[model samples]
Target chain A: MASAPAGTLYRGGEGMWSWVAHRITGVAVFFFLLVHVMDTALVRVSPAAYDAVIATYKTPIVNLMEVGLVGAVLYHALNGIRIVLVDFWEPGPRHQKAMLRGILVVWLLLMIPGAYFMMIHTIEYLFGSTS
Target chain B: MSLEIADPRSPGAVPSGRARNRGNFEKYSWIFMRVSGLVLVFLVLGHLLIMNVLDGGVQRINFGFVAGRWSSPFWQTWDLLQLWLAMLHGANGMRTVINDYAEKPSTNFRLRMLLYVVTVFIIALGTLVIFTFDPNLA
Candidate 1:
């Protein structure tokens, strides 16, 4: 099988970025899930141990990291819903572009409010309430 | 799924196929993968940094730490987003792989239905856990 030229478009409708993202997110989530479960199970270890674990979350940088986790999970969830519809339903291919746009708009809308709440709470927690 | 090369010069080789029908669903799925992938990069990376690095590292984490964080609405929402997004993104990706590979319609249907059930169940259960978490419970 001869390799195609560098810029040639593949025949299938599937986009490369999406496929890569899906796989990457899946692996990341799976890894985190293992760690999360193990950490949560620490509750059974002792109150002192559990408290020690929770304290690490207070660092400002850690809060920043939470922002990324939220973003990853949001993108993955929204796109996953889109994939589900495509696979199970045999709709005409023409509508693919429209559906993609719709997914993007929906994701943006949801994330805005979700992120806003996260920020407000973070600020309140870090700096003693002014109001 | 083998790709066939169409010959333009052959007498009988004039394309016989009709214009491909553009399905709305597929377009959306394609778009979704790109958008989701871009976002996942940031989220996953951020999560790793916070959990493994920054301020006393992983050793300082504890129940009071979680309680303190969640006591604020901010962390709760952050966590909520993470749970929902990751699960949905992963399930969607799996759906794509299934569609591309699954041959039998019945098998596809059964597998998808099962996937839906499990995905919904986990999402719901996770949401509940996040909201109802008790910091004081011994």
Candidate 2:
């Protein structure tokens, strides 16, 4: 069969977008892991030095960033599962579009509680709940 | 001159066997990404819960807290496996990205070389840190 013209389903639709999103999130998470390992490695320097560096992570700004990180990781993980199903399941291709919608719904559902739990400490601190 | 036809089944006429039996690196790399990704979904999400959402989150995590956790063989093993798996997984993912986007063959080789260097360095550093962490270091 001849290929569909450029703007068809496989070319510029859900499949493409999911592919783009996966690559973007994967790259972001990969770079973050590099920095995270380096930061964790600070323990070998000195406890004080390590604690001093980790202190930055506790700040409200970075706390919010952690929520974003969680979002990226969660999306990547869920989408990754979708990819696996597409590769290994017989009916996966037929249902991939529907699966993307399902993945997004699940991602949002998890992110709401995830972001809240991750940020609750920062929220409390900002409001003077703790010293 | 009469033309002679070579037999396809002759040893010299056939291609080398090694060509057909070359390694399955790409196939294994593809399989590795999927397998490791599935494992990481559990390991990383669990890690996030414990480190970022459970008690006080990052506020309570310091050197001592790290020491306390690494004191256990279980946690040490958990972290060591996590470091290696996540780093290798990320490296492979980045290599794919570079392969897809780099316009020139030379650029691809250079970028992947850089990626390998950093990936190996980070993995080695993380492994050493996890292995050599001293609880009593004040």
Candidates' lDDT values, in order? 0.62, 0.90
Candidate 1 lDDT at B38 equals 53
Alpha-carbon deviation at B22 in model 1, angstroms: 11
Instruction: Give the Cα error of residue B114 in candidate 2, in Å.
Output: 0.5
Candidate 2 per-residue lDDT over residues A74-101, each given as its tens digit: 9999999999999999998888899999
Estimated TM-score for each candidate: 0.50, 0.88
Give residue B122's error in model 1 in angstroms. Answer: 1.5
Q: What's the count of clashing pairs in each model shown?
A: 35, 0
The 10-residue segment of model 2 chain B with minimum total lDDT is B11-20
| lDDT, model 2, position A131 | 57
Q: Write the per-residue lDDT of candidate 2 for residues B1-138, one digit (tens) a residue.
A: 999676667746654665456689889999999999999999998999899988877889999999999989999988888889899999999999998899797898899999999999999999999988887876
Chain B TM-score by candidate, in order shown: 0.72, 0.83
Q: Residue A45 error for model 1, in Å?
A: 12
